[model samples]
Target: MSNETPLPLVMLRAVVSGGCDVTPPQRPLTPSGRN
Candidate 1:
């Protein structure tokens, strides 16, 4: 078996992590925009 993650999953993880980093600081200022 190959020990490798699919490309889509890798991209998804990157996006999620980046979103978490960006969202927190923006959440307070735009509480109504981000849910």
Candidate 2:
């Protein structure tokens, strides 16, 4: 598998890890129904 990962995956990880405090409105990148 490639060492490079998708940008969304990285962002998700960051959010899950508490590294990113993204608000629902600010995070339009993900349409996972958070809005």
Candidate 3:
């Protein structure tokens, strides 16, 4: 379980960081348009 846990944790962190960087710029555009 310990070994399996680290693998997914690393992948999730990578994906989360990537998504955050990509999403933040795009998010403002949509909300600004609505506002």
TM-score, each model? 0.56, 0.42, 0.50
Clashing pairs in 1: none
Off by over 4 Å in 2: 19-35
- Of candidate 1, the 10-residue stretch with the lowest lDDT total is 26-35
lDDT of 1 by residue, 14-34 (tens): 999999888877768666555
Position 12, candidate 2: lDDT: 85
Off by over 4 Å in 1: 1-3, 29-35
TM-score: which candidate is best? 1
Tens-digit lDDT string for candidate 3 (1-35): 76677877989999999987788676776664446
User: Order of all candidates by TM-score, from best down to worst?
Assistant: 1, 3, 2
The residue-by-residue lDDT of candidate 2 on 7-34, one tens digit each, is 8988888887674455645768877776
State which candidate, 2 or 3, has the greater TM-score: 3
Please report how far candidate 3 places residue 19 from its true position, in Å. 0.5
